[model samples]
Target chain A: MSTATATRPATPRAELAAEHGLSPSSARPPLPQYLRQVWARRHFITAFATSRTATLYSGARLGQIWQVLTPLMNAGVYYLIFGILFSSRRNIDNFTAFLVTGVFLFTFTQRSVTSGARAISGNLSLIRALHFPRAALPLAFTIVELQQMLVSLAVLGVIVLLTGEPITWAWLLVVPALILQTIFNTGLSLAIARIGARVPDVSQLLPFLTRTWLYMSGVFFSIPQRVHAGPLQDLMMANPATVYIELVRDALIDRHDAPQHAWILAVSWAVVAFCVGFWYFWGAEEKYGRG
Target chain B: MADIQHTNGQVPTVIVDDLHIVYRVYGATVGKGNAPAAFKRILKRQKSPALREVHAVRGVSFTSHRGESIGLIGRNGSGKSTLLRAIAGLLPPTRGAVFTDGQPTLLGVNAALMSDLTGERNIILGCLAMGLTPAQAKERYDDIVEFSGLGEFIDLPMRTYSSGMQQRLRFAIAAVKSHDVLLIDEALATGDADFRKRSEERIRELRDEAGTVFLVSHSLDVVTKTCTRAIWLDQGSIKMDGDAETVVNAYSSATR
Candidate 1:
């Protein structure tokens, strides 16, 4: 995301005086500088991608098939246990697809945020020694998770087709919805990464966070139907996750309108979550670089 | 004045001023009135000390021009590593400013590194971490591998390498940068005598190309040989700053 700029901060060693736009006291590179860092580290990502696709796929029991089959298996297990045995399928149409969409999106967010949270803390050596932007830490995890989620996306499309959820222009809104979701994840990932790094306890609590998040994020039930009547419904609707899931459901399940103001709400929530998360994360940038 | 103009054109690779680094460790300040963590807390390792802020570095400042090789000399807890970190922009100073001409690469010596990563993979990351692009990283990949001489082991997890082997690889990776400044934190201590000799040669090449280096080492011999100047820090303050031979000799005598 960061392209190299002409006026990059050199190092902590050189004093820039008054003319350099540097306050003379500030040595750290700015935000755009971090993007350049991400660009520079593309080789690490590339090498890792090559190795991962090989090692993970080749050394596995199911090989590349696991990429598609893993999420399907996950959905099937959840569906059998919840949709059939528990009889929760009565609430939503094409319950399999509903569960799959929710599961896939929520899982993507969960993994991206949790793994990105540890991105900097885990690479203890690199962060301290390397003079690049730290934002790349979370982006790396998001990129890797997004790559893995590609298979899940394909499965999602196939599931939608088989379940006969008719594709339409409203379904095209899924692209923007997905973009918003990714943006939300990036912001949350950076924020959580900062929290997890300093506290140490956060690392252990992350799985719990993800699990609690799944239950509350409307993975099991549609928002409006799940919580009916009173302030509870209002409260649930206020949740960005509820909005995100609803937008996805709207696009995939009810795919024909011009996307109502509710998608606007989801998009707005994504922006807010990103801004809040980014600000929170950057606030800790100083702490992350310290010993 | 004139110095500011010329300085901008030929800025010192690194500058540090009135820097203090304090860490607010959530651990007991005094040992009394505390029990071992309970099971749940223990699982989370709730080893909280009566919450005191430990001051790691205090009011330190210096500037080094390109082609200058500087050494950090101090006892443990005297803030050598903290000082290097502050200078490298890895650690922000609590109450001062650090300025630089270009990005610096910090080469930590003798650190317990992951042996599971191959030397080559680590090299790619290490070089990239030093702020080189993919093509740039790839260009140095072979040179760094050859310099470290890990050959077949380049593909193996670093865990299998002995301490000495890991040090050589880390040194090669950190030093592979085309940096205006490079920070070394005793990371070269594990290399063999031959590697050290060759590594010394590379440090000079970097300097000749107008790069600056801030190296921290306990070895007086390394300081005297590798650096032109030295800052002897004590209790996080600069006690002596002069030619390497002068400051190191004075610090050694005072300690003795």
Candidate 2:
């Protein structure tokens, strides 16, 4: 080995600082700077989300067709099980429209929350290697679901129109309902992503939790008629999922009776969930990649 | 080399003060056949799972100045990677602190590039992650492709490329923008001779531009060739810190 000495005398701390500018390292960037960083990477997030959504069904023979088919198939199954076999559609006019709407809307939230939970855990390698706003992961996952939902929603509009529901002014309300629900979904996904990073098993538990949430949201049955004056009804009414579903149902279906304050409730839930979730996720920003 | 400037009087780029890092690994087995006992304990729900804490870095302190190329040499599990991670701000210190003049970019051998996306797309993603604006990423697009020497292969998915190809691509993207602090964790170990030579030249250029480089490599030859100063870490603390030749010689003799 070449035994050349490389060590030199330490520079005076003051002179070193004066001669070459130095700032303390390892400090987390301020919130505004962090947000700017995230915004600058918007193209990356969009490209990643789009690419992931495209490759989701690469192995299947049908490929991108699965995005539209999956929700329609779920609607078909629920119509079979709950509408005809169980006769839950009795006294409900245009029950097909009602069932399809419930299934499609609920699935959007379910997929968003579940996929968001896995966003950080599944991409640990990327998280460890790259340094960007960690929020981009959960946000990207939510955007994937949003894109899928848009495709599914187009099919849903045709289904409801074909099922004899007239395109009334109320149908326009679906737009605002969708906007509110998407905000709610984004917030929930952000919260779940943070939790999932810390306790990976949360992803496993999410299916059952979302399933229970599905039933409570009245995807197949009407909650107001069956359960009257109980805490369960109150819980269902207060649920963001249920409120959003009710808003969509009231707007799209004729006979469905949504609460008078459903829109207000939906907006409140969306705003609160989004603010709280974003704060919760940002608080643990530095801890996301490290074990 | 004109690019290799002395950093004696420069401001310290990195200051690690009595840094301590502990990794909490759950359910570490003490011995064989303890599974049944552990299962029963879990079945009873007495408490949560067992916890084993690994002290990866124990009170290590070092000051590195701009324009210095420092090599960290240690065996597996010696906490070299962990310390680099802590300095990168990826891993929070269990105790003490790591202060740096600017953001430290860590380029590891296993840095995740999207396998499903084309190399071109991955390049853009990597540039964005490194804080480049979309326009800047587009501006440096051709330079990155040329540096990687992927040529037409940039249009193919990253999974189709060999490991060496992937490493070169990663190095290309990271080197596209000059960073104030660059931390390399075994990134050079996988490169070919030509790639390694170019990478070493880039490190020297970065150092001359007043960037601090912390390289962790198992190959003593690479360290001796590329780094001016070497720190030998044994267990979780610095064993020796001096001229590259002296530290490498001591470490080699002791290990042999």
Number of the top-ranking candidate, with lDDT as the measure: 2
Taking all chains together, the TM-score of candidate 1 against the true structure is: 0.81
Q: Show where candidate 2 strays beyond 4 Å.
A: A1-26, A30-33, B1-8, B27-39, B43-50
Model 2: colliding residue pairs: A25-B100
Q: Would you give me the overall lDDT of model 1?
A: 0.72
The C-alpha local distance difference test score for the whole of candidate 2 amounts to: 0.84
lDDT of each: 0.72, 0.84
How does residue A54 of candidate 1 score in lDDT?
45
TM-score of 2: 0.91
Looking only at chain B, model 2 earns a TM-score of: 0.90
lDDT tens per residue, model 1, B75-183: 9889999887766667666666666665566778534344455676677766665557777888989988888978898888777888788888888877776577788
Question: Residue A170's C-alpha lDDT in candidate 2?
Answer: 94
- In model 2, the Cα lDDT at residue A277 comes to 89
Candidate 2 structure quality by residue, lDDT tens digits, B1-256: 1111345555678777667889988766554437687787779985535577799999887778778899999899999999999988888877766667777889998787888888998998888777787899999999999888889999998999999999999989998888888999999888898888988888889888889899999999989988989999999999998899999999999999
* Prediction RMSDs, each to the true structure: 5.9, 5.8
| Per-residue lDDT of model 2, residues A38-101, tens digit only | 7877887887888888778877999999988998899999988998799888867788988898
